[model samples]
Target: MSGFLEIRRGRAPLIVAFPHTGTDMPADVEMRFVSGWLARKDADWWIDDLYRFARELDATCIRTRISRSVIDVNRDPWGRSLYPGQATTELCPTTTFDGEPLYTGDGPDNAEIDRRRATYFDPYHAAIGAELGRLRAVHHRVVLYDAHSIRSRIPRLFDGELPQFSVGTNDRAACSGALADRIGELCGRSGHSHVVDGRFRGGWTTRHYGRPDDGIHAVQMELAQRGYMDEPADPSPDNWPTPIHAAPAIAPVLSDILSTCIAFAKGKE
Candidate 1:
């Protein structure tokens, strides 16, 4: 409940974070953008809604209503690339995932980028840390599940269609090997395409707070938008952001995934 950042506390030893589902754009910030539509195009559209079942598991949920177009909370504030040589956006991105310019004029300068990081990015992570501390005090182990979604095809970012389930543990540096293996086993039986440590291997949040030795097991689940919603091939303002209609089969799978996360945190193994 800190400005645009929202945190719902739960007794369960699990936390779900939505870093990119936000669409709120401040007037001053929007004025500098090429178009609001384009700025929001790459958002993890309706992702928070897709994972509504998290609440039923009594899992804490943390989210930011401030759009990623404003400042990607999941990215490293120090400006280091999470993927190093891969195609990705910055902490304060100047363009969309498709390499399209996002601002009418030159994007935010270094000073402005730093300001955004302080005003928006810092608080988001702070909230996450606070929740983790609270949950960890009660349980020996806690799970931080970073939820994200992207278009099935973004040629600029990856080759061919992205897998439906893109689980990332920073090559298993973020979470315990047992946790990673459990998630991998679930995805393998999901009847959907999946890859581990592929094009995406978790972002800064996953890499930073994930300390298995300290009992914080973090994992990032990046879903292909096509799995839960209609993703038009050529997305325009008119045909973009197809409504979220979780496929009948996909709904149960998502439930099971979160449930498994809860079980894992409870040491159910």
Candidate 2:
């Protein structure tokens, strides 16, 4: 019933959550974004389509339809940096991923950011937590797959290019060693470039909800946008449009990853 967030219940113990696939910009907030200020360019395009296997596998899913430009559901509410010393966006981003300013003049200040958190960020996280509780109540163990994607060659975010599959578990603290090792080995065997706890060592979602001791495990999968799409040279309104579709070639790779995750959770359960 909530437009800000959506949770699809599944029978499987695994949950596939897409926190960055949202593109909706509230009316009041939309005007705040100056025309061609690059707010829409930085969206995590078609991440939900990448994880369509969730529904097929009967995997629970918690997603937010609200744009990250409104409030990053993956960020820490305490304002802690997910990646320190790195140029990362905040709860309410001030610019696009390509370092383009989003507002001509002053945008939302401290008070506004806090209000958005209460309205969007807090509810989004609460949905995740509630879904985890729901799944755990049915299954012995529940695994959360925090899904995200970004442009592969964003020099502002990282040098060179991002690997196809970027896995993170907060340096193996978020889940059992066995689970992490299994996923890592599976990813490597799939012939895709995969890294464990590399630049994306999970986010607030994985760090906060991952409690192996409590029968809840969390892991983040950051994929390069190139893995699923032909990223435009410039991701903007004129160039990159809405309903960003995922390429068919990447389906098997992602489905394989999700299947592996489900197997791992079943094993743990």
Q: Pick the candidate with the highest TM-score.
A: 1
> Which lDDT tens digits does candidate 2 get at residues 1-269?
24777888888888888888887888888887876336667777788876777799999888888888878888998678989999898889888877777776787888998989998888888888888888788777788989988888888888988888888999988987788887787778877788999989999999998999998888998887776677776666666744445455656777876787777777731
What TM-score against the true fold does each predicted structure earn?
A: 0.97, 0.93
Question: How many collisions between residues are there in candidate 1?
Answer: 0
* lDDT (C-alpha, whole model) for all candidates: 0.90, 0.81
lDDT of 1 by residue, 33-105 (tens): 9999999999999888988889988999999998899999999898998887889999998999999999999
Give candidate 2 regions above 4 Å deviation.
241-247
lDDT of 1 at 87: 92
**After aligning candidate 1 to the native by TM-score, how far in Å is the CA of 247 from where it should be?**
4.7
Residue 152 local lDDT, model 2: 81
